[model samples]
Target: MKNRSVLVSGASIAGPTLAYWLSRYGFDVTVVERAPALRPGGQAVDFKGAVHRTVLERMGVYDEICRRSTGATDMVLVDAHGNERARISGDFTGGDVEILRGDLAAILYEAGAGHCAYRFGDSISTLRETEGGIEVEFENGPAGNFDLVFGADGIHSRVRRLAFGPDEHFVRHRGYYYAIAGEPPHREQSDGPRRRESYAHNDAGRLAVGSGAKAQQMYLFAAPEMHFTDEAEKRRVLTEKFTGMGWQVPEMLAELPVLDDFYLDALARVRMPSYVAGRVALVGDSAYGNTLAGFGTGLAVVGAYVLAGELAASEGEHIVAFARYDRIMRRYAKVGLGSSPGPFLAPKTTYGLWLRDRFLGSRWFGLMEKFAGDAKDDLDLSGYPAWEAR
Candidate 1:
């Protein structure tokens, strides 16, 4: 292999998965994460179709993932009176299997940690391409040069900013924002049966969902773009958007201040002509993210597999490998383009909400599910024998 040393930004799903494959293919891989440690328990993410299952099986984590899987939970849409108006099956939302984002990250991290170097609580400060390779400067650690770098750092990726351009040029806000707030760390669970159904209450442009135990809360609302400087701002924005809402919303908001795990971000999408620029390439959300579009995690895992396989197949010729990676990923990721789940989840008009409810209850919803499954399996995945033999 010509280019054996590589750096991957982000320790979440995509970065660690990429690190695992690259190291397995005999390349020296280093993963950099901004967080001090792996984040635990935010929201549930799922994998669908044969493509996702195949990649998991290849990585040898399929059995473990299944053991840790949180079987799909059905969602019920309810009115302020606490009457259920519509239901969305777990099969439709949760796909083949579902797991918490935190758990999946830990699984990928552990699988790669034995071979790949990990630097947490640090992030890339700068990137300069030299005649030999790319020189990278870190926020807290010493700088180093590497043969290649990848941005798997979500939509607002620091690596993307340094190598590509500003956020405005690539990330497009979809006029909606979503937030997830969980129970404080080590909180005791109430004595009762675990929540099997999640209830959603929507009012015009806002939606609030709460589990049976109220252990996790999710909110989605339509709004113009706004930049929040701190957690306080995010809390305030979330409160303002759903204050007048009914159902269990008031109680959910009341617990926000005490919650330790709180996340809020705009529903955005990434648009770029190519995933590669010189020696730097992007994967996962940094490449083709459409927030809550239901394909982000699946695309990220599959992209990592393809990228590492291509590099090993090409004998580490990044120019050839990156071009192939970009071409394949762009086509497979098209399903996530030009679509946003914001309006569907929290419609801006009463009629829109009614229409959504009707659609969910109609036969067409089945067809929609079939279409999604097909889109996920659209790729003709190449069997890179170099990695396969190992």
Candidate 2:
């Protein structure tokens, strides 16, 4: 087997997925995650574009995701009193398949573990770039040398800071904050609430409920317009904002006090002008986390595909592979991010929300259909030059 030792940071969607492709290409791969184990039931994330779907198919886990998808049929724009002014369909709002982040993580972990070496409850402490490669210090295991190290870690990547610099130099907060925790839907849900009536359940402690789709799992959170100077401050702010919102919001907040990953700062997009430096390269949210526009998940997978393919095509020449990967991947990323997930996440103002609600009533729903088709074509992987694995 051709084994060019590679050390990857982060074990989320990107890192493990990258490990899958690299191992397929006969590379010695090791992944490190800060979390002790795979986190369960995080916010629901989805795959819309074709490239993402392609990656899942390639990994042989797409079918599993389809089975686990929270097929929430509808959503209501609700008021405190539970009055629904507008509603959106799940297939229309999410993608062809939408699964909880934890479920997706589980699928990836199952596919990747045997093929790649994984180190949990640890991270890279320091990195020194050199002529042959970079010297890395681990927070847990013994330090070692590798031909290449990747920062597939999420938006708040330690590899990015160690290799590049502080996050302030890269992340762009899109003017919002959010927090979430798993809970039981107060009103009980089969497909989602048929009608919109929102209120606090005294014992159930659910807000505006209908299990996401299955009614088996639920979550609640509050997002306000605020700028978090750093990740630490972001969690603190969430703690403050959600400490007492009543209903299920308070419960989610209460849970936040104990867990580590429960409270995520508002949506922030990682914007790096370039993703490569010498022998090292960054992928996933570490490089261009267009969380604001296309919801980083698909973009990360597409990037992983292109990166591993380019590396294999170039026979592990770092510079050539990274440049080609960036050239092809960035354009698609720009197109999708430019499409704007911001509006869907949090409208800028009341007027903007009103406009969105107005559009929901229009037969222009076909616009979304056309948009989805165009997006699928845009994510087409056949356009990429495939590499013959050694």
Provide backbone clash counts, one per model: 0, 2
lDDT of 1 by residue, 1-390 (tens): 788999999999999999999999999999999999998886888899999999998899988787777777789999998999999898988888888788899999999899999999999999999987999999999999999999999999998899999999999999999998875112123432122578899989999998744478889999999988999999998998898889988888888787778899999999999999999999999999999999999999999999999998888999999999999988889987867999999999999999999999899999999999999999876576446676
Query: Where is model 2 poorest over a 10-residue stretch in terms of lDDT?
Result: 198-207
Q: How far in Å is the alpha carbon of 322 misplaced in model 2?
A: 0.7
Give residue 369's lDDT in candidate 1 (0 to 100).
92
Candidate 2 wrong stretches, greater than 4 Å? 1-3, 183-261, 292-294, 339-350, 363-365, 383-390
Query: For residues 156-201, what per-residue lDDT tens digits would candidate 2 score against the true structure?
Result: 8888888888998988766544444344223323553222222322
Which candidate should be chosen as best, given lDDT against the real structure? 1
